[model samples]
Target: MGNISGAIVMTNLIQVGIDIGGTKMLTIAYQHSKIQARSQISTGKDFTAADAQTEIERFIHTLAAPPDGIGIAIPGLVDRAGVVIACDVLPNLVGWQPAIAFSSICPVKVVNDAQAALMKVVSELKPQTVAAVVMVGTGIGAAIYANGMVLSGANGWAGELGSIPIEGKTLDAQASGAAILAQLGIDANQSNALVGANDITALQSIERAGTSLGMGLAILINLLNPETIVLAGGTLQWRGYLAAAMQSTQRYSLPDLWASCRLEVSQHGGDLVGLGAASIAI
Candidate 1:
């Protein structure tokens, strides 16, 4: 499999990428295909868009000089104008217009986090075929690439997978990292709460979340019959969670579709989102 970690140098222009995730925020500066600077900070569940804006401004100033362009990857329904319309995980971001705010500094582009992730790896995907990138972090979001382009519905909200209803509940409420923590009755502010957990309750919580995630994937497979489905995000660190999800996906997905699709784990880790955002800026 092609690795997504190394630099894909294509230009001499300087660009900045900002990834605003449910639990953390990452920022990077790239020039000539190499990262010149990087920064990361924890963002608790209570973190709001206002807090994110402050952090973004601070990170930009820390760069040696202004970048030629900036790209931001964020979770939620972002409109064509880069305004976040709705975000279940970070509801305060609704109506937040980061792109417009930063446009004065440089050309800015804002997109859904999963869409940015798919863009980061579009080169590796089979041409003119359906491919999906699913990120299972604090929330579950996906992006669909078909016919050699990312699919954007009329509202620019084609892949809001996390909010889709299943079994009378939103997928995010049942399958996401936040959902897993909630199932275990753990505090959302506590990081790594599931690591090394071996109790029956913890195991059951993991299984429940994993099953939900698998069901969501099965739905995608049955609907799109994608040639590739790449899974990424911090939650995959839990081996048990991934195992349960795979088993359930295999069980729930149509036999033909399951066999046709190739499931892959992303080689790029925490930096993948930021890199994709940088590419968007380029």
Candidate 2:
């Protein structure tokens, strides 16, 4: 956990953060910016919105103190009304009212997962710096932070980079983990094992996916002119993939923008979304 702000020094307040992903859900309990307890559950085919809420409540029960506030990071586009508008990765969550569902539990704030990740990145940067976060996992998603806040545009669809059209197909179709695995004839269930092995075909496919991801990021850089770009997600774990992505980003981005913007992987690791969501409560 990062350093807690001075505002938290005068009181004993517990905050809960939940990160809802397509394959798993993680809930963390924090007191004075330190982790008190954490829990994880599989978001399998049987998972539902109610399951997520129950898991969150269960994690809260493990904490030493009751939570005063809660924050949830959800995958997909979240409307201003706190409704999950579109979540192709977790179809069951579409139109769900996460905040309302958890309202009785505590004060709650919900954010798009990618936007939450961006918030985590911004928290570590110098104030007022423009930055962007691009996560290439099961799918590709991005969020931009400009001035002092995240740029969630009208309809909350501002950062749906995965859905960006490229060569008559969506960016997700060309660069996501599923897409890469399909291109390499690897079963979705075998992705982790195959990624660990020194398989030539898998490496090549990852490189190709990296190139596609870089192209998409280059467009974002040209438009946003951010000072930094943080790359996260499981797909970036492959060897040589980050180098490929950087090279392609340079190739496609305007020279000045590419030169001025620093591109690096996320520092928060797996705790990114949880931490970001917790920031809302803090």
Candidate 3:
């Protein structure tokens, strides 16, 4: 749709992307880099590691009952190869190595979900933006860039903006999509039903949430000094009222950094995670 119109396109081979979040598990059928089919499954607090695995297989099964490869976005650390360990919200998967068993399902690739969100934005957006994709869905996470190199930190833990301690608590504790929803005493189902997003109400709701988002971002700007911050994920997409609060909070961040950087909502396609996973596999 922009300058790089022909860079990535769908072909005939079957490709799938699986996103496992605290609230849901999503899978899509893609050829080349375009999504052709998609489905979402409920992943409540009761979801277990085995259940997550099952849903993954089922998502694949629905797409021709078999696929060439499946790429997964798990909320944990993945080694260079694609083994998943260390999960936050997905306690049922705590310490288990997925590659050992999951490879049998298909040629699989796995990565931290936050990294996938970052991949979506970086692969498609303009490089000059110096963007940071902050995902508040399931849990809080971010991916940053300077020129073209995505910040990987000392280990693979660099993008975990959620763990940064603030106000005697981490961002996850005070402003996560789930936590914020809980704070407002709104059940996710109710929010989704009312607003078609994990966070709802609009006009009034967007303003307050945007303030919380800005507060969380102030810490990021102070640390990384990115040029633009892109807000992604289901909750942020669903709510349309938080922009004002975000702007108000931005006023207090490092003046020089804020003055230079741009803060805007994300416009990347949904297939970004899939393409990123494919890029990882390739």
Candidate 4:
């Protein structure tokens, strides 16, 4: 696949992209497809909309020049006006318009993180090809693209799949990274170490997560009948676990639908959100 930066360029205009998550915030600046600056910072315990604004302002100050426009990818439900309606990790941001706060800096656009990732995926696809992206990080979120546009749905809450009920539990409760860590009784910080050691408990937890995720994918397949589905985010780091996930998808999805769709893991890694946000800005 071609680099995401190759898709959009705004001559000499410098733009900024921000990807905000529960634990960290990443910012990048680019002009004419070349990176001018980049930074990442921890979203400390007292995280709030104000705190995020403060950090963003500080990060921008580090750049040699001000950006012409800014795009933000946030992990929650955002409205068309760029207000955060709800968030699981950043509860204090609910009802806050962080984009408005940044208006003085540049034109701003805010969107759901998963939707932003989907925009990046859609940019790489053949025109009008149906696609979906399922992100498994601290939680699960999905976005669909069809006819060269994102399906935002009514109320802009279309891809909040993590909240969908599955076997009397929410998908996130059974399949998210937090869920897997809880099931394994391991600290979030120690997940890599435990998984790397091939701990049986950790492996079992991942398998369970994969199975739950597969069930969710099956539902999407049955409904959207997408041509491609991309699996992404931090929790899907284990290849064996992903294989199990594919197995569950094959088992639960209709044979015809499963046969017609292709499954892929995101190759963009951490840069996915940043690139997606930048795509919106440019």
Give per-model TM-scores: 0.91, 0.90, 0.80, 0.92
lDDT on C-alpha atoms for all candidate structures = 0.82, 0.78, 0.66, 0.81
> Could you tell me how far off, in angstroms, the CA of residue 155 lies in candidate 3 after the best superposition?
2.4
Model 1 clashing residue pairs (backbone)? none
Deviation in Å, model 4, residue 41 alpha carbon: 2.1
Q: On lDDT, who's better, 2 or 4?
A: 4
Cα error, residue 152 of model 2, in Å, equals 1.1
- Give per-residue lDDT, candidate 1, residue 257: 97
TM-score of 3: 0.80
Clashes of 4: 0
| Candidates in descending lDDT order | 1, 4, 2, 3
* lDDT for residue 276 in candidate 1, whole number 0-100: 85
Model 3 gets an lDDT of 0.66
- Candidate 4 yields a Cα-based lDDT of 0.81
Candidate 4 vs. true structure, TM-score:
0.92
**Top model by lDDT, which number?**
1
Q: Measured by C-alpha RMSD in angstroms, how accurate is candidate 1?
A: 3.7
Q: In angstroms, how far off is 147's CA in candidate 2? A: 1.6
Residue 241 accuracy (lDDT) in model 2: 73
lDDT (Cα, tens digit) per residue for candidate 3, span 209-281:
5566677788778777877787766666645535554775577698898887777666654444545554443
Q: Which residues of candidate 3, in runs, are more than 4 Å off?
A: 1-12, 126-129, 191-209, 237-241, 268-275, 278-281
